[model samples]
Target: MSTYQYWQVKFEHPDEDEEELKAVIQGLFNYYEAEYGVRRLTSQVRDYYRLIGKQAPNHKRVQRLMHEMGLKCTKYNRRVRKYDSSKGPNGKKGKNKLNRRFMSDRKYQKMVCDITELKAGNGKKVYLEIIKDLATKQVLTWAIGQHTVFCK
Candidate 1:
């Protein structure tokens, strides 16, 4: 299927009024509240509009128009820790060379190091910095802090 049907939604030349569209959206929300006894965890209000014989606009368009009309959703602050794909395919990875190779003809010729984050407590974040020599496998330097913002 096309990402957006790959075709513009053609209206009847003269479309529904702005106020009417807002009213339809509001009516759907009211219906959802009444029938569902509060919005469901994964509720998309506009879905009800289509079920009730109303053409629901695209989600992005609904979001934009609703925001312009001072009607916005209270987004839940929920997130699941995502896998860091830049760290390569799963398993333990040292670091991304980007181009430079890790192999060397002689010992102590090159070194590789990496840094990672560890979030702790309720809000106060901690930062850890480490530097190590790949040739010797020796940790050269390390540092930790409450905030880990890097300088531009």
Candidate 2:
């Protein structure tokens, strides 16, 4: 099994009634399993206890206990991350002129465009390209169709 990242919630419960804590934990897991059909429900369970005036449990303990209870996030229906950088043609990489700054002096000094794909009613992916001006925050151009050919 793959290990989880440590974006986990941690706590030190002073009111450590063992049976009470176990019951609350069971309810949290049960609710999430019924609603989402997924075991990656840590955040939701933490939020539930927070709403009920109870301290959240240590993430390590919760994860260990959940695993003992046979709860795990399944990855059967997950799609693979697939992308090819060397497809078709070459593109120019511009200089790091702005250096991560979000502000500029002159209008249209720099422009950026991004494309998003949406699944249509007929199950076909439709691409939308949006070009924007930096200084004025205006949309310069846009096109809607089906193509992966991103260019300047």
Candidate 3:
């Protein structure tokens, strides 16, 4: 069956005023009063009902109403930590061979190498290794592999 029909069957008789609740939800999201998602918005709506001495609506109903109105919280859901300090210092750490000099008078005299991973649409990651000439600003050579471990 359709999702709308399922929800309708589940909530045959809703408790709260759906129109008013939609307005409250939209106001909460549009005004940026607080970081709100489904769970937080549900509690805030319940608090509003409590303050008005009326019965609060169920969270599922609120969620359904919010979905219908296309009101959503745009807050970030995850935190990304860039650096990891757990690994021990390896002996392979090398010094700055270029000595902060990026320019080169001759072609291929100075080059920079970098490796990065690209995610494909088939859920597989492809690693690429690129060598670029610093003086000419051109890519010299490149290699792509499914599982290329450039750093030990």
Which candidate ranks first by TM-score, i.e. highest? 3
Clashes of each: 0, 0, 0
Report lDDT per candidate. Answer: 0.52, 0.62, 0.74
Tens digit per residue, CA lDDT, model 2, 16-135:
554465565667667655343234455665776789888876666667666556665443445653333323345445566668885767888887777776778985677777888888
Ranking by lDDT: 3, 2, 1
Give lDDT: candidate 2, residue 73: 49
The digit string of per-residue lDDT tens for model 3 on 34-139 reads 4688898888889888999998989998899888887766655555323222222562455678989998889989888776777778946777877899999999
lDDT of 1 by residue, 12-99 (tens): 2324655666665566556554333123411454566567776656666555555665553333334545333235435665455536
- Model 3 alpha-carbon miss at residue 78, Å: 5.3
Pairs with steric clashes in candidate 1? none
Score candidate 1 by TM-score against the native: 0.33
Badly placed stretches (over 4 Å) of model 1 are 1-100, 105-109, 149-152
